[model samples]
Target chain A: MGKRVGLEVTVAVAEAVALCRIDMAGVYPITPQSHIAEHLSNLVADGKLDAEFVTVESEHSAMSAVIGAAAAGARVYTATSSQGLMLMHELLPIASAMRLPITMAIANRAVSGPLNILNDHSDIMPQRDAGWIAVFAENGQEAVDLSIAAFKIAEHKDVMLPVSVNIDGFQLTHMVEPVIMPSQEEVDAFLPPFVPHATLHPSRPVTMGAFSMSDYFTEIMKAKDEAIKNSKKVILEVWDDWGRQFGRNYKPVETYLAEDADILMLTMGSMGETAKIAIDELRGKGVKAGLIKLRLWRPFPFAELAAVLKNAAQLIVTDRAVSFGGPGGPVFSEIKSALFAQANRPAIYNYIIGLGGRDVAVSDFVGMFETVRADKAKAKADTYEFWGVRE
Target chain B: MNIVENFDLFAPRLINKKELFSCGHRACSGCAEVLSVRLMCKALGDNTVVASATGCMEIVSSMFPTTAWRIPWIHVAFENAAAVASGVEAGLKALRKKGKIDDRYIKVVGMAGDGGTMDIGIQALSGAMERGHDMIYVCFDNEAYMNTGIQRSSGTPMGASTTTAPAGKASSGQKTWKKNMPEIMVAHEIPYVATVCPSYPLDFIRKFEKARSIEGPSYIHCFSVCPTGWRSPSETAVSMGRLAVETGVFPLFEVENGHYRMSADMPKKLKPLRSYFKPQGRFRHLTDAEIDAIQERVTAEFNKLTQKAKFL
Candidate 1:
């Protein structure tokens, strides 16, 4: 038997090691991502990781503990699923605004609108503007790689924003795979110890989290926005540095086979693999097409996406979420806005598919193309359609 | 740190500044919560930022554009002052770390009503504390949800008349005793937790100064005398607050690292609790039996505190 380690194993090991490299972690239990916390608890319990494992009261407490531990200049970490993420939703904005460089793993799942707990982007989608640096992982290896990368990007002097590493619930979180685990010394060499710019200490006292009046409230918000905006360059630099260390490169938007294609299919999370297969099959059939995987959701890759879409005749943007009453899915509207300033932007179409873990079959891709071809046939058709579901 | 150390020896000199509390705001004329705010402002000075929840203090201090806060102040929502403060703290730290802002250390304070602190806010407060954030959380316990009409909060004293705990027919209003929050805070084992009242202005100011000086989560429970909710003459607010402790109903104390100390240790053979209970219009309808029950409960709780302190 040829021994093999899957990508999922790599993700869990990478996260566990990163927490060790960073220092302490406090977490509570939640679905689709319980293994990360469990591994952490075992590490701390078994005397492997020298850190505090606080069995917090709830998910709210879990996030709270991270904030506390993180503020204390510890490289704090935690993991949760959709509902747990929502339970900590009110605190997310707080953590982000506070500029805590906490790295959390979120197993993307459908929010309970009508009793749903399956894989979807809805959970992380709602928290887009909560001022977090949100990153999506397509596979198990990327999950591990991106998680380590998240710590660097978040703790950057210019970008002291909380970062969330989201993987597809059950699809990626529960998948068993062999992974190449990095050694502690190499990881330490790569990720330096986190030194907090501001923290609570008994000796050097300073007040934090104070009230702001009309004269300064807007300025405070402006400062946060500016910091996050400037973080793009820092994020790219960190990615480059990580690639140098681990020999794996990450881009905000990954493009495949778009050189001379008339159509482009774009997506994020695990389903990007499915879209990649569909794109490959369509290309073999002599349909000029390409695939784009969006890795970063927040500090959205607007400039990059627009640049990639410059030569496209038509774009099929797949979203695993809904905006309820909006024109298209949430990602669809965002993509349109990203291209709004570009003069050479191509026509974009938003396609909602694979929601609630409904199988995104090959026919789904065919349906997506049919809609695009229909749009090409009619010059003035609407910009979006919900795939695999009736209007 | 040196300045924090120095301020303890001498009463902090107040820098001359414009009054933050506006004239036409909606607080009771003798409201201790507003007075505490004014005093805290004087001590914290203009360099500080204040965040308040939707309570008596927030309602009176801010109204969109018109605000009593001359210094930087924010009000995000109820039950999130601690979480919001954590954000502000992180923001300031990042700013300082990046050298974007000057190194003049600013103090952050979060004030909430009792309902906000003792109930809904506990989550955020626990978080801020667990994060070990350096900030002060002040709960102005008027003993009930005074802002949204006189409803019974967890802090509402037993046998008291609240709209939610009406004393008609079979019920005696407010069936349970006021939750001992200072003790609960002590359970968090935070560095500093104190109970204060504006009636004793110096004590209240000292408590604020102490809490602000502590590094970690320091809780200060201010006994706010709400004239509107308490059904008493507004002018008698200060006297009632004094009687609260004098009668051992609300003992002013500080618990630092589990060291329980009373603010003013009362006579062993104390005045009847009725003197404290009978005056308030809310307590006017409490029967002799109910009053006796409340008095016994209060006395036993007070005695328990003394016993713990004596042994410790």
Candidate 2:
């Protein structure tokens, strides 16, 4: 059994990465994500982690360096947030297309224009089509577990794709909580050493990142799409193995008092925990309110979501980022598309909450439920509103 | 200083005979850039990994399902080959230290064109050199962006007409002086920095071999001639490189540990710059006054370099 200690989520994540015994980490610091990079560099400097810590100049070079390290058959890791993640956007798809198993942590924050460094999903929303297996964490414990599992999942023989473990920027990354710090022996037993499918080596030469023309571009993209879609099986298997080993089990979509409830509120990231409090308060008041927390964002658990929201009459979907001039929020658009073909779909309402780290408290969750209930009669499935807007 | 003294016309036969960069690449018929790459690969031998930037060489050598590279190669993006080489070198070092991989001495090499090196890639290159990675970065300087149809780059010489900076009634083409990349690299205080042209194959091979022997970062700026982009005849590719050197437009020199050394037997007096410019259509639009001004600047720059070699 691992020791349970109170540590900041970012520190816990760095500790977990050290336990995984990565060969290299190319990191550049940004707001809210600097702690993870600092802790990792400190671990390398103290001789606690036997890895190369490359202090890259920018997030672009950070991503590029890791891609090269991974291509050289080294187990590599990196972390960034907000503008830094935006800077890394160019190389994200390249890493996926090349099928390099590079693990990264995204401290989700609001991107600039107003120049805010706060918790939001604005950072990761743009990267949805980058073809990475993205997972969200609700707390410190999940952050550590997901950071460690990300390496195993990415390095899996069948699923040779990069993975991003997203933790809400300052909300979860700075929050201190009791987390089980797994021992090196246990982590080693759980995750095996990486064996790359192809590497840049002189003995066996392979040309990677070749330019493709019209004749082969479509076929290559199709293969990449199939690879990410098929990786869900391995993700499930790894989660099951983790559950069997550790006492804590994880799910794609977790429910709280959800069974037999007619109205359910859906949330992702740390806000899901806050919504649970609202659910409990509503249940005490003799209301049938439940909570659905989405953990897996990519290779999205479509069937699992459909099964959970099957019998619900009303669903309040809250998103942290807005999609301008498009249909509501990015998540809201995807959720609507996921349930568009269903026979008995609920009246779904999307509320864009928490712009630039505005606090979404328990009362905010209750207020959303009330608004959905009052508008249930005339509500269309596609309607969305920004919650707590000044005007 | 005496690195190339023992080399002759037959000296290349004594070097590695293996051709790591295979044939059937789609470079133009008289492309000196590909020839420079081929000579570099031969000099480095088989124990090397090449990180290429997206440019003419990368596109021509690596088309999907058909690769001309017989050694390990990667082309990540346009501006990050040095950064990628740093990662490859660091990864190899860590793996060797941890006993995860063999401890063989495999050299990491980065290759990029002028646009990839002088313009978009300068930051990554400076970072890698400042970090002191044990790698070699070779800038195949074709002067302009030949792969994208002769766009103007920072390395484009003054009065050289490119597609983007065309000589016209209003403009004189490529008004700014060529960026001094080798000097910029020397400012980083890296151990080895050299300028090589394939017009002198033995000298080029010797510098590469010497760079391989160095235990730290080395920068080799290769002067490549682009006949198509320069509007010169195909057969003048090799002669063009010779003219570039003999006219002192692109001198062959080395900066080792802050000491500058010119290649042996440089001309006592450089040939006229017009002799170098007359064969190329890109510079045919240059007025006599423009050519005179360019000649004065080139002479002054060559003298300044020779003075550095003499004193430093």
The per-model lDDT (C-alpha) reads 0.75, 0.92
Instruction: Point to the candidate with the largest lDDT.
Output: 2
DockQ of each: 0.11, 0.82
Tell me the tens digit of each residue's lDDT in model 2 across A1-391.
Answer: 9999999999999999999999999999898999999999999999999999999888988998999999999999999999999998999999999999999999999999899999999999999999999999999999999888889999999999999999999899999999999999999999999999989888799999998899999999999999999999898888888889997788888999888888899898999999999989989998899999989998899998999999889888889998999888888888889999998888888999998999988999999887777775744556788999999
- Report backbone clashes per prediction: 15, 0
Candidate 2 residue pairs in backbone clash? none
Q: What is the C-alpha RMSD of each candidate to the true structure, in Å?
A: 7.3, 1.7
- Candidate 1 residue-wise lDDT, B152-233, digit = tens: 9999999889999988988889988788888777788889998888777667777777877777788888888887888888
TM-score of each prediction: 0.75, 0.98
